[model samples]
Target: MSSQAAAIAPSELLEAARVSKAWPFEEARKIVSRLEKEGGVSRTVLFETGYGPSGLPHIGTFGEVARTTMVRRAFELLMPGVETRLICFSDDMDGMRKIPDNVPDRAFLEPYLHMPLTRVPDPFTNEYPSFGDHNNAMLRRFLDTFGFEYEFASATEYYKSGRFDPILRRVAERYDDIMAIMLPTLGPERRATYSPFLPISPKTGRVLYVPMKKVNAADATITFDDEDGEETTLPVTGGHVKLQWKPDFGARWAALGVDFEMFGKDHGPNMGVYDRICAALGGRPPEHFVYELFLDEKGEKISKSKGNGLTIDEWLAYAPSESLALYMFLRPRQAKKLYFDVIPRAVDEYYQHLAAYPRQDVKERLGNPVWHIHGGNPPAIVLPVSFALLLNLVSASHAHDKAVLWGFILRHVPGVTPQTHPELDRLAGYAIRYFEDFVKPAKVFRAPDEVEAEALQALSVKLGTLPAGADGETIQNALLDVARGIERYQDHAKTSPEGGPGVSVAFFQMIYQVLLGQERGPRFGSFAALYGIDNTRELIARALAGGDLSEV
Candidate 1:
């Protein structure tokens, strides 16, 4: 362990966590306080997050697991020795009611509508045996990418293997009570057909949605009319029957003795129904947390069936998993856009938090997103340069490959190689991908107007006055000094609606537009610092001479 990490005392972490205002700490404290108030801690605390598996797992799905893991970490700190388990439960048995528009090439799923997901054929790969198996594997694969410690559970396996038989029977026993709580939440048509138990049809191999004609709690059998109008009686246990979505939610909680579970904001309205069902089944309802929804480009809530917004793989393609975690950690209860544009800021902010972690005291560190992201042990190290700076380097160099970026990086920071600076290497690759997708397509380098061209010439002269290896701050201040000397910028500094720094800001904006083809960017000096002071002068020379700024 690094000295910085070793210096963080466990006792200090515990004390800080007790008083920390961090959301995860607050959430974890809720669990600790609840357990204490309910007499004493006895059994293992179970943390659960559910996935429908009706569509491929998206980044929003990743958020729940990641956030819950953060809370679990905080809880461990407060309780010290209490046992905890995080179960990433997949509702793979849910009927393929609607095919997702975004999963790609799902025309084969139409004929299998209403069949359990596990019963449908795997459309993409033969290795998974069934569509449900395929999706469950996808969820597991994404979770595994982050090294999340979770027990994977499937609704189909749990139902078929009799692990849920006990709860299934209890659900049957309290069928009326569960129904009483659920019926009021449905529309008249849905209420007339709804049953807590849905019998899996032996003939059609689909979970039937018809009304239960006879419910015998004594035998745990539910009699329902099939599509053919034939009366069928099936035992609720042994996979012959499954509960409807809401009842299944409640019974799953009871069955697992879940101590804490989280669901989307959409389900916040149905919280009472789930809890009542759990109580009717003679089990205590676990604590529930409702987090906000993720939005697509139009500010519409992202839906699984609609398949909107970025997928887990899409986010990973352009940013590190740590950055993604940081995005999920910040203000989770408030809705935020989950699109390509958010990646750059998330990446830079994560680096900022990681860079700050070592210097922050216990309470301040507890509030840092990276601390929660890394479970209170954020890496004491960071990439040599910020992600924003790397993006600028990629753009200014117009390098098509990571090798080219590495060449530049090695020149600026000596002795760094793919082996010695792996983080820098990975960041370079991500920056290149981001640049190609988002930056390259949108780039439109504008020629500097007369006054701006003169400023650029002046800026280049000012930079040359500095030593070859001047620090980023010195280089930045010198560049600003040149801008302050420009007549147009000085006039704008007093009259600009944005205020005095508008002079420096406008000057920097002109530099970025002329050279990098972006509206805004990292401080020119920082980019120069990482790209090297001499290299920056060359870039300015290219800009002034109207040469191709993209080429080496």
Candidate 2:
């Protein structure tokens, strides 16, 4: 152990190793321990995450990069002062096998089929040079917004700049050996013509997948037949040739000296193939981690081609980036359902972590997801109210502005303003938007029955008796007393069999429907306390009055 590692308590290190048993951190610990054992290494450890620029960036892309970054952070915490580099590699040189159906103006991209994504015109707008460029821009935009520290590598640029020349030569020299490894995995028809090197047609500029007639390893050139019957020869050193998927993956690992890489479980079967190819070319494969894929609400696998999952933009619109980071911080080996419905809980969970961060001890704090989400410096401010409560406040009070929400917030958490708690303020906006979309549309208000109405009336009277300066706990207890009283009344009234309204789940649902125009909401007590006694009385009276419940 180094001085820094020694400075850290052994118990703390043990805790970190224990946290690593969960996920990503587990993989990070494995990689760091393995690398530590391999002496004489004086280079920075390279951690790479990649994207296939076939479609616009989505939540899965964000998840992969975000999770890898968390692991990188965990690695840093475990092995202090170890140099590390993270690269977001984009495979933009891959030919446009087909124009994605989700893109705008698909008809316009038809002409560019079979060309590299970098070569296809961006059908959405001329703002970007090509489809690949536009997608790369979107990827970088969110990455920058999330504050990920990474170096972006474009396959098109890397190949054309001769940076991959040595790998290309290695692929050429080991073509037969690579074929031996790949052929067994393909069908007979595919095996008959499969070649590791895919030479771009000099005539049509399309990437040709035809079998290589001859490979001159000494000359670093390959010979293949073009679209016509004529044979063509091109130097593979430049961008004239690109390797197939499996070989490209292995070659990239070998060329970049990637120490850690991860992919979806769909690629789990291909790990050994890439590892073998990399080892064959005198390069050891990186430490690999495979995570399960995200699923949509219907339990279908989220796919870029299927356009079935939530997009990163949609997620950002409804929740803070930290919430999304927390979602990614969970165990990666387990499949997670990603949809809009999960947003509110994620938002509240992030706030909970922030609230708990300062109170935790140093060892526990280091292992907290908030520590990684905030890069070891979690914010000190804690909102007394959760995001769900904020949403109810937005709906109940018609708070169209952050100032209005802060009016309630400042009452509980004094000395904090929208300026100091920007994340909370941002969440307030998302809450309002989410309330408008998901909550408002589905609300169906039903009048409370007679006994229930009487209970609410009694609750209102009790609330009015409370002092104006009553705290949340006080208000919460009063509200619970009202609920318990209603329940006792309902239990006695049950003997009469429909003589009075029953205080069941419907009672609480009715309250939610009346105040927030939803069948479910935050805890009534906490909400009542945060919303203030006076406001609570007004909302309850409005619900009982059978007048317009909107003004409450």
Best by TM-score: 1
Q: Model 1, 383-412: lDDT tens per residue?
A: 678889889988987878899888877776
Off by over 4 Å in 1: 1-3, 414-419, 491-504, 548-552
Native-to-model Cα distance after best TM-score fit, residue 433 in candidate 2, in Å: 2.5
lDDT of 2 by residue, 1-552 (tens): 011112457667656655644465677777876787887446688999999988888899998899888888878776767799999999999899987879867888888888888998887888999989999999999999988999999999999999999999988898888989999999999998999898888788788889988999999998888989799999997899898999999999999988999999999999999998898777889998899999999999987756787999899888878889998887678999999889999989887877776666666666678877876667665565689999888888777777888898888566778877676787888988998777767667667778768878878888888887777677766665566566544444443333554345565676787666787877787788778888888887877888676554
Count of backbone clashes for each model?
Answer: 0, 0
Global lDDT of each model?
Answer: 0.85, 0.82
TM-score of 2: 0.90
Give candidate 1's TM-score. Answer: 0.94
Q: Where does the lowest 10-residue lDDT sum fall in candidate 2? A: 1-10
**Model 1 residue 364 distance off true place after TM-score fit, in angstroms:** 1.5
